[model samples]
Target chain A: SAVISQKPSRDICQRGTSLTIQCQVDSQVTMMFWYRQQPGQSLTLIATANQGSEATYESGFVIDKFPISRPNLTFSTLTVSNMSPEDSSIYLCSVAPRLGNTQYFGPGTRLTVL
Target chain B: TQLLEQSPQFLSIQEGENLTVYCNSSSVFSSLQWYRQEPGEGPVLLVTVVTGGEVKKLKRLTFQFGDARKDSSLHITAAQPGDTGLYLCAGVGHNNAGNMLTFGGGTRLMVKP
Candidate 1:
């Protein structure tokens, strides 16, 4: 397990405003991922961030809406652009430390777009 | 897209009871993992099973992967109030080794004291 921390544990933002969430890991990792968990729903992958590369987003997600920055291996940021009520969800950051399919997650960022 | 189905989307039981959560999929997974999440927190990895017919135990919790690698089960014995939370099962279907994950609809468990 890894020690992962997310910034702005909870936030209330107005619609059309953008919010940036930061993820920091104690140890440098190779792969970092962002996920969205809707209220009462399971997690859905938003994007996969590898160091020195553009994030690969899932089908339902796009880079324009969720811009990701992975400037290093251990830290990354996800910006929710032009936020709406539908973007009100728990955003989580996770990392895969090894080749095995095990991942450790950080305490999520609870966002509410009013 | 690969889909994983978890049975009994909701489970409510009293302390000292045993419960099992099942995850099934038509597509075979390279590996499967189980996670438990509480409110205001992220999902925590409990265990991961890679081989077919493999079983792993953590204290009172037992996880088993089916022979065909398309299904799995998590059984908890002597459930306690602290065991209440959302249980999720995720699978890696592609051969990229941990690059991607497809999660199943979670099972909400409530163990009342």
Candidate 2:
């Protein structure tokens, strides 16, 4: 199992502002993913932060809206750009140390855009 | 698009009662995982079921994977107040890479004393 941490446990941002959430893993992981959980809804994968490469984003999500950076195996950051009230959601970071391993989630960053 | 559907979106039961949650999908997955999440916290991995028809137990919780690899279930025996949380089932598609997962709509369980 891997331990993961996310910064800005909770934040209130103004519309049109941007916030970047950081995720740190205790151990080097083979994959890092960013997710969004809207109020009373399931999580939706935002993107897979590839090491030293552009992130792979899911449909309905775009790089211009959610930029991601994975500089190394143990660290990654996700930026929610041009925030809106609709973007107010809990953002989570998950890591899988290896293939077939359980993916561990960070505490999650709660964002409220006003 | 792959989707995991969980039934009984909300469940409230008295302590010591037993409850079950179901997750179903039309797409086949290589592996399925169950997670528990409390309010304001991230989902914690409870167990991962890989092989078809696999059953894994964690104390009072039991998880089973369907023989077709398109469904799963979580059963909790003697539920407690501590068991009140959101239960989620996720799966890794056979064609997906980098261990990406598709999460099911969660089941919110509230165990009353």
Which window of ten consecutive residues has the lowest lDDT sum in model 2 chain A? A96-105
Candidates' RMSD to native: 1.4, 1.2
Let me know the DockQ for model 1: 0.69
Tens digits of per-residue lDDT, candidate 2, A1-114, equal 888989999999999999999999999998899999999888999888899889999889999999999999999999999999999999999998986567889999999999
Task: Give the alpha carbon lDDT tens digit for every residue of B1-113 in model 2.
Answer: 88999988999999999999999999999999999999889999898899999999999999999999999999999999999999999998632456688999999999999
Residues B9-109 of candidate 1 have per-residue lDDT tens digits of 99999999999999999999898999999999999989989999999999999999999999999999999999999999999754332467789999999
Model 2's chain A TM-score stands at 0.98
Count clashing residue pairs in model 2.
Answer: 0
Please give, for residues A1-114, the per-residue lDDT of candidate 1 as tens digits.
689999989999999999999999998887899999999999999988868878888888999999999999899999999999999999999998765536889999999999
Q: Per-chain TM-score of chain B, candidate 1?
A: 0.95
In model 2, which residue pairs have backbone atoms overlapping below 3 Å?
none
- TM-scores, all models, native as reference: 0.96, 0.97
For each candidate, report its DockQ versus the true two-chain complex.
0.69, 0.76
